[model samples]
Target: NCGTWFLGRLQTERDVARVLDGLEGAASAAGNALDRSEIGTLLAGLRSRVFLMNNAHEEGHLLFHTRWAMSYLRGPLTRKQIKLLSPSAPEASGDAPKPAKSAVPTSKSSRPVVPAGIEEVFFSSEPGTYRPYLAADVTLHYLRASHGLDSWEKHVILAPLEEEAPWASAELLDRGDVDFSDDAPGVAEFVAPPAGSVGTARFRSYGKQIRTHLYQARPMSLWRCKSLKLQSKPGESKSEFASRVQLAAREERDAGVEKLRARFAKRIQSMEERRRRAEARVDREKSQYEQQKLQTGISMGATVLGAIFGRGGFGRATTAARGAGRVAREREDVQRAEEELRDIEEAIQALEIEVEEEARAYLAEREDKAAELEEVVVRPRKSDIAVMGLKLAWKPD
Candidate 1:
């Protein structure tokens, strides 16, 4: 049953997915189109937000499939994996059931088994596309109960199908599980039969086998997340829980990011203001220094010219010529200094204006972010929403 909160929750998920999809598409279109600098910036941002230091493997588990796709596109090797399968593969393959093959053997007898140090996964592909550019077939276990509160334990093994990816070990991607409890209101446990028990593992596999088979046949060029946070209660549907979690995560992440940005922006503005003030002071001092130097030089040159001419070492015409030259030189120096002072003043003004603009923007953004955070953290609780139902009134006729 979709509760009153379902609509908003669903919309939030769709919105997030849409945004991530847009990023992925843009990155894909930039196929071999983005330069190293651009890629590096995107990569750096992703790393700061999604990846841990020195842990490239964590990336697979951290971001959603769509986010991963976008990041991959921004990577230097995006183009190579974009064309995983030839466009002209057979339109459709006739129905052919193949033999059952194990993904990761638990017992491990010379066969490929789930490896160590592998955790988290995200895989995705476009709708109606048989292949997934980002592919990982995982096996997980969980529980579902209807009567009362229940617990869910799940294990998933994710494998990337990309040929170029450094971590393409299918063996390592074969298996994992999660152990969770659902005691919150309107929630229950997700229970299933034990392994090698009655029901088919395929059904128990949560359609993983089918997805894996399809991925092998036709490589998909899409993004997906193999790893998902499954903290949802039994009463709550998977889709609904996924929506809420995504929304919560997005809200939290975005708020933190904005706060960081505002903090840094304010800092930058302060620094810039300080720089402008310093520059202005320097310019003023420089102007004064130049004026004094020029005046002193002029005075000295005049005295020298007077002395040279008064000594009668040269004719009257020569003395007058020397005086004119000295005066002309002093005039040019004064003009040049004035021009430089004007330029410095203009630069200082421009910097001051920029600092003011940045300050305004920073304050607005900070205020908006603070309001948003308050709304999320301090808004009315579910009980309040349920209690404060809308009242419908009609005019008496």
Candidate 2:
């Protein structure tokens, strides 16, 4: 019977061999392409990792985790080497998925949603490693505090922290809920389980799966994102009174500019009419003078006899008086036209200057905030697990 122990150990070694075969294939399948010698090194590294389990469990696998697990097992966290966790290198065949689109930030902070709306607003933050930008920051600073991530972790995601809903039957889960504790599930518990362990002791270990799902919070993409909020009345949460006010202000200002332009046009038209009337009177006076010259073609001797009589010679004098009056009126009309044109031109120049000055002032206000806006992006970041997105956690009223 003692000699038959070889048969039992033979089956165990066979299982071990099967696991190695799978690991080898997976390691080579990556685009990085692990060689046979590299596969041997990978196995060695996996075996050498220290398992920090409690007294309850020790059912370990030869390759229970992905490639990232090896990196996690290795020591001190470095911010420079942070990246999204991926099992394989990006494929050259275009099968690999692209990273989600991120919101492009510019030198402006108070961004216009469409130059007339508001969604997210950003300020500034202290520089350094944080969240999505710093992948290892979560593992090293958060997960490594106890090295507690498990192979089969649970997720119960909900909406971000906000006002309590009208029909919420329960309070929103807090950080204290999923926070790592002795009672909370950990990778160590998976390594070892307490006696009287029910179905898969690791999964049931102090309800870690349930707890992880409870406090799940979706991280924000922006390093410095602030919610754009409006002041509300006692009973109204969705009212957009503030935005309405903003829209009204823009309409009024634009309308005023149009009114000024109309007034300027009318003044110029009146000056043009006065100039035309003066030109018409000047033409009539010139015609009368020409008719007088034709009638007086008779002679100077006849003119001398008429001059003594004082009636015939006075006809030429009357034409001259009327021409002089017409000339004077035309000169006044010309001066009026020039003055009106100058007034219109000055008004246009002033309007142009006002627009430029206003633009300069607005840009100056954003100048102080530019340094922070350039470094970060603010895209819509919701929990990937929450497919429908953060819904009304409580039953709708």
- What is each predicted model's overall lDDT from 0 to 1? 0.35, 0.32
| Model 1: per-residue Cα lDDT over 163-258, one tens digit each | 333124433222233221212112212111121111122123423443343334322121112222224444455456556656655565566556
Residue-pair clash count for candidate 2: 9
Q: Would you give me the overall lDDT of model 1?
A: 0.35
Residue 55 CA error for candidate 2 (Å)?
34
- The window of 10 residues in a row where model 1 has the poorest summed lDDT is 387-396
Estimate TM-scores for all models.
Answer: 0.22, 0.24
**Model 1's TM-score against the true structure:** 0.22
Candidate 1 Cα misplacement greater than 4 A, ranges: 1-235, 262-269, 311-397
Worst lDDT run of 10 residues, candidate 2, spans 132-141
